[model samples]
Target: MFDLNNFNQESASLIQELQKHVGEITAIRRFFHQHPELSRQEFKTADKIAALLESWNIKVTRNIGGTGLVGVITKGLSSKMIGIRADMDALPIDEATHKDYASVNQGVMHACGHDGHMAMLLLAAKYLSLEATFDGSIVLIFQPDEEDDAGARRMIEDGLFDKFPVDCVFGMHNYPNAPIGQVMISHGPQMAGTIGLEITVTGLGCHAAHAYNGIDSILVAAHIVVGLQTIVARNLPAQDAGVITIASIHAGKANNVIPQSVEMIGTIRYFDPKTAAIMEEKVKSVAQGIAAAFGASADVRLKHGYIATVNHTEQADFCIKTAQKLLKPEAICLTKKPSMGAEDFAFMLAAKPGCYLFIGNGPGDGGCTLHNPAFDFNDANILVGGAFWTQLTLDYLA
Candidate 1:
């Protein structure tokens, strides 16, 4: 239980007003959880978000970057502007949480807590519209395809800023398993950049019994897999952060026959562009060299992904100070480490200065980790997160 007496009179009043709407905001979060949509396929999700914003008399724009939308709340005469974003897509996992409001749609769920994120932002919008007084404009971003594709990048390519440019942007995600009301942030690299890797190894096929009859692609792939591990160990400097994981591999279906080809796919994560390039070079070199030694051929393809989410120094400091004023002393996590997980919000940060922070979503004791089938966003955080966003917005635009 947070004590309102710790805050200034005006801040305390705003929190009290936001508390009155907790039930409504929680309902909205559950509604989104029940009807989750996949990346780039959020038609109904977009419609619902737009309707809610329009009903509040906020200016709404739709179909930016394929299903992404924007809502603008303007007050006073100052042109200074701020942008706040929330991702709208869900994952491909089937719901197993068995909550009363569990997903009605098959094979899709809001496993990443995007439902909670949207609800918090909407709560901020409602309060800002009806109660708060501030200058300049606030842009509420409803982004799509954050789970599988980079919807943030898509929205930027669609000219999100050119149309509704803001001086700075801010984003937040719900962190599962931490203390329910705690807030976490990093002053520098907050999330890692990613590169998608695909490798195909080609060799001759033969009967399994006659092991020497032809070149074995599976044997070559096995060697390559072991070799890729060395990129992080032998190639990269230990001080730098990097990961190379081969999550999937495919080969011959028949046990009695040797496969002619093997395909492997995985991801590379890193904080520095130079480190990423070094890892890429090592992967291609090792794979090709090993395949040739085994009398086979290897082809490597790399797809560029979201950049590392680096927070601007001044903006991050401002957020830290703001969190201190709003949260309990123990609820602020200044020592939290950056995550290897990637985020498309990096694209927006690249376009303008901003900060990305996280709000804790309680413990993960019962299959409650993110992207898990049984995971559900902690409903109680609706009020906690709502207050943080509302306060941050009021302070930034003050």
Candidate 2:
């Protein structure tokens, strides 16, 4: 059995030490937030991360899978290895938060709290380097393109695991709904997989004055959009969760013109892989049938996005135990249901047995939901998150 008293004492001391660096962490997060970089184009972000990691005398690798992945490895006495990941990409949304640290980059923002993740992991690196708290090795992964492109998969494809074999991997995201300093975790199906779909309905364009002179692609798109809803409502099982949303529709630019074709783009989300496949098929069938009814034809394309973030039960339980030992029992909340959102960390989980959890960023008073313009990574959670990472590393490597 692990000694709770010793663990608590050590964790509390670490938390106190982390608090001292809160200002520095906040500064780092703000700098990244101000100069936000988009998906795969995180060149500046990657350079900054590399420079920091190397400053700690931690061995660092750059341009691993692409231009934006920084892999820092610490060799220790024990051979056991674990990996910790932090995404380094920002969203494409324009800054709406009118703070001094508001995004300096035009039409880009760190609305998802990735900047905080990076800072916390960097703090972990600094602490680990100073104390050598863990017996085994730790791989610090700062990945890029998590907002849209699958940088995790790219790293895996480029032999991330093969190069530095890790027995287990762990990831964390800052959740907005949960209260600050509270940690939430779950055993399985933490987040859903996503698919982005685009459908183009083609029809004969004719003068708007004539009634039946040509097929109406706009009407066909509208029917397709409505028909797409029945797929989740009728086909999917009641217990299984699935969603289909038509987010974008474009056809005619002018008031009176009946455009030649209408393009519709949407997203599909599901937890189960089988259900996801079924939903994709249903989407195509519905689009084709709706277009046929309108005397039109549709070309449907579905692009597979991120996979479901499913946590390994054993790893999750271990993480919960670790959290309980480190923080007050009330600080950890076990989630009752899985979130419908998708995470690129799913790719890392696919490669190894691991878990993904949430470190609370507190309620959004003025801060909006994730991806919202007013959202900012709460500075209050910095110490909480950094302490959690440090403790988890020690516990896992113990």
lDDT on C-alpha atoms for all candidate structures:
0.90, 0.84
lDDT digits (tens) for residues 169-217 of candidate 1? 9999988878886778779899999999999999899999996999999
Off by over 4 Å in 1: 1-10
Per-residue lDDT tens digits for candidate 2, residues 1-398, read: 11123235647677667766677777888899899899888999889888887878888878877865655555558888889999989998998999999999999999999999998888778778766556788889888888877899998988889987999999999888777767788888999999999999999888787638999888889888889999988998899899999999988887777889998888999999999989999998999988998789999999998999999998999889888888776677996478888888999999999989997777777756799999988776767777778888888778
Clashes of each: 0, 0
- Stretches of candidate 2 off by over 4 Å are 1-10, 71-75
Name the top lDDT candidate: 1
Window of ten residues with lowest summed lDDT in model 2:
1-10
Q: For each candidate, what TM-score against the reference?
A: 0.96, 0.92
Angstrom error of the Cα, residue 339, model 1: value is: 1.4
